[model samples]
Target: MMHVLYWSGRAGSLAPLCLLIECGVPHETVQVDTSRHAHKTADYLRDVHPLGTVPALRLPDGQVILESGAMVLHLAELAPSLAPAAGSADRAMFLNWVAYGAGSLYPAYQRVYHTDHIVPDEAARPAAREAAVVALDRCWDVVEAALEAGRPGLFGDRPGAADVYLAMLALWHPAPERLAAACPKVRAMKDAVWALPSMRQALAVHGLETA
Candidate 1:
């Protein structure tokens, strides 16, 4: 059994908990609230992670693992049934999608968050919001097409790392209404992935279960 150090309500940490649920292993979720700045303490820095980010998984051997990308992928590997098998091309594709979500999509989402929610200047809100909306639209376009491309749920058989990550993105995205209107395929993917039992448990706990 593994123990996970996490902040359940946080955007980044939520998917990791979803991964844990999908993994179907006996693990414990140690709540770390970022809103209260609990992850910034020295004890957590030394004990949980140097960066003190939530969603760090503690190994049974006492090793602490950090970073959202690495955490989910590691859990995916450990719970191979949750993710895809690391055999050949499918493995590489899975990694690509996973990395793409963390790297490109996350950055793009950050821009949207900064422009939409975090920014304080009311005068510049429209321009910034438009810019962020454009970035988000571009990102979703790719995802929408990918969801429509040949495979239904990130892959043929089941939802893999890509599907899971993308589903969370769709769930946490700022402009879900716009996405539903613009990218029905991605909306379809979101519906399919969230329908999984793992996603249900994770999202349901946080009141994110609604369509």
Candidate 2:
């Protein structure tokens, strides 16, 4: 069984929770309420995730994994059904897309939604947010093109951990209208991923109906 440190309604927490359900892994959820800034406390930063991020997973062997994408990759290795085999033909693309979503696109959404954290100056937030919107839309376009080329799923005929990561980011990004207009394929992909029973259950836990 894995143990996940989570906070409700946070996008980062969604990946680990959904992966656990998809893998049929028995897990315990330790809620770190961000509403009260519990995640920012020194105890949390030191004892849990050093960067104070939620969705850190404690493995059965006393190893704690940070980064939602890293957790998904590890879980995929454990449960091969969740992703392609490491050396498989599709594995390289899968890995690339996962890293792109986490390292590139996800931060763009962060800049849009958490502008205050990105720039302390209130006056500068507008420009930052506008720039993020452009970057985010471009990111969506890239993913959409990739999905269109790889149809049925992100990598081939079936969804993988990378698609799950994409879905999470697509849902969290602030410009849904822009996303729909710019990345119809990705929007459709997200719909398919969310329709899965595992993802449905995960979203329901946070009272989310759709994304």
Candidate 3:
């Protein structure tokens, strides 16, 4: 069976977990409690994730896949319903938004959550977080416009991995209500994803069922 190394409440793990459930694949979840520094352990770092992070996928063959975006894509391959058909018209748009969520939005949230890592100076950390928030808002603006124009889902009428990925990131916003108010389309997408049984199961495990 495959294994997903997870840390509850960590946003990075949300999309992959949801996809795994959506795919109905045989998988196990191994919690690497950040509060106990389990993710920083040498064994976990060497074997599970070189970066010592949660949401790494240990395939049945023992090949570990890091990066949640990669995990989502890989899992989607196992169950194509989670994504647009490869080379289809919507495929490019699907890939684009998935990359945007993983590359642009994820990093922006990391900047806000780990500002000290970027700005070493204590006095500058707050400013760094503020800047990250602005950048995050801009990223959301792009998503909002896309959602408003696109189908109910990020790429189609069906909620796919890209929609799940975006919803996972949206929940991490520093001020979710403010973001929702500013981007109703984004909110609608999130609400749609949230209603999925697979997503509800994943969210319950991550303690985000009420989110």
Candidate 3 runs further than 4 Å off: 3-5, 149-151
Better of 1 and 3 by lDDT: 3
Q: Judging by lDDT against the true structure, name the best candidate.
A: 3
Model 1 TM-score?
Answer: 0.86
* Per-prediction TM-score to the true structure, in the order listed: 0.86, 0.91, 0.94
Better of 2 and 3 by TM-score: 3
lDDT of 3: 0.83
- Candidate 2 lDDT over residue span 132-189, tens digit each: 8888888788887777743656765666778888888888767687777778788778
Task: Give RMSD to native, each candidate.
Answer: 2.7, 1.9, 1.6
The residue ranges of model 2 lying beyond 4 angstroms of the native Cα positions read none
Q: Candidate 3 lDDT, tens digit per residue, 1-211?
A: 5555455466488788888889888888877788888888998888788887777888888888888888877887888877888889788888888889889998888899989888889998888889999999999999998876445577667789989888888888999999999999998888888888998998888876566
Write out the backbone clash pairs for model 3: none
lDDT of 1 by residue, 71-189 (tens): 77878877766666668787787888888888888888787766656667889887887787788789888877766544547776667666777777777677788889998888877
In order, the Cα lDDT scores of the candidates are 0.75, 0.79, 0.83
Question: Which candidate number maximizes TM-score?
Answer: 3
